[model samples]
Target: MIDLHLIGIGTGNPDHLTGEARRAITQADLILVPHKPGKSDLADLRTRIIAEVCDDALIALFDMPVRDDTLPYLTRVDAWHDEIARIWAATMAAHPEAQKIALLVWGDPSLYDSTLRIAARLDPAPRLHVVAGITSIQALTAAHAIPLNTLNAPVTISTGRRLRDHGWPDGCETLVVMLDADCTFQSLDGDGFDIWWGAYLGMPEQILEAGRLSDASVRIIARRAEARAAHGWIMDTYLLRRRA
Candidate 1:
């Protein structure tokens, strides 16, 4: 069986890598790196991190398949994952001598990433090993210097689409949203909620804005657009809480 190591490299910083993640990378026979065509910065960052932390492994870089945005959202993502799986299989097939393969996952694989799902599609599925890294949620909380929850209250993690599609969730006063292409907070009408929003968390170009949603929503949207244009790619997450 192939040995698969899903190592979380943390957010965007090379130093965010844990000792365990470093060991996993160095121990692997081969490490597969995905190269997103238009998002070359992200690809470069991942490659740099691997280079800094893993000195002994053979690194194989492969082009990432573009997800077809024309198809309906879910269907499009499904097709994209299929394409990625095919590429991954081919890559591994070419390197049969690689008994242990490592994938440097951004943040934890257990989060919103689909690397785990794609791994399942392998013909002879590898024995999976996971080393958890700092998630965006952790980075957000740490950057904001605030606890994720208040007085034993619940915190719900969601996506921007969910927030727009289904207003607010029931029974949860605190919400953390990720994978938001649009500023969905504007859709929420920005009432009494306080927001702690951050862009490029844990990176050198990190930007943060926090205040009443009503006060900060517009600025966050404008700043996010400017930064995305400047960097060509942006990954951001925010926390919203209805003041208790």
Candidate 2:
């Protein structure tokens, strides 16, 4: 049976890697890296992280297949996952004796990432092990040096799509938004809500802005665009809350 290690490398910072993550990389027989077209920089970032942690492990790199977004939402994702599984199978088949394989996961695997689910589709599924890393939320809060929620209050985490469709979550004073290509804060009716936003958390090019949503919405949107242009990519998350 193939032993697979799904190691979370945290956000984009090399320092976020834990000692356990370091050990996993060193112990792996073959480490797989994904090559994404039009995004060579992202792959480079992954390579840099691996280089810092794994000095001697054999590295295997392969092209990542783009999911056809045209198909029905769930169906498209499912089909894309199947293709990823096939790609992995092909990559591993070349080195059948490589007992320990590792994939560096961005952020925590159990959060919104699908790496774990994709691995499940592999025929004769490999024995999986997860090494948890700091999540984007943790990085965001750490960058800002603010607690995620007010003393003992609850926090609800949701995606941008859900925030736009459902509005603020019920029964929760704090809302943390992620996976937002569109700034969903503008869709809200401008209540007394306040926002603490960060883009590319933990990276040197990180951007942060926080204030009453009414005052900061436009600035955040403009800054996000500017950062994306400068870095060629952006991953942002925001926390919104109102005093009860």
Supply the global lDDT for candidate 1.
0.90
Q: Write the per-residue lDDT of candidate 2 for residues 1-244, one digit (tens) a residue.
A: 9999999998889998999999999889998999888767778888888888777778889898987978987898899889998999999998887999999998899988999999999998899999999999999888888999998888899999898888878787899999998999898755579889998788887889998899899999999999888877789999988845
- CA lDDT, candidate 2, residue 110: 94
- TM-scores of the candidates are 0.97, 0.96
Which numbered prediction scores highest in TM-score against the true structure? 1
Indicate the TM-score of model 1: 0.97
Q: What is the lDDT of candidate 2?
A: 0.89
Across residues 53-111, which tens digit of lDDT does each residue of candidate 1 receive? 76556888899988888899999998988899899989988999999999999989999
Can you give the lDDT of residue 237 in candidate 1?
Answer: 97
* Candidate 1: segments with Cα more than 4 A from true spot: none
Candidate 2 residue spans exceeding 4 A from truth: none
Find the 10 residues in a row with the least total lDDT in model 2: 187-196
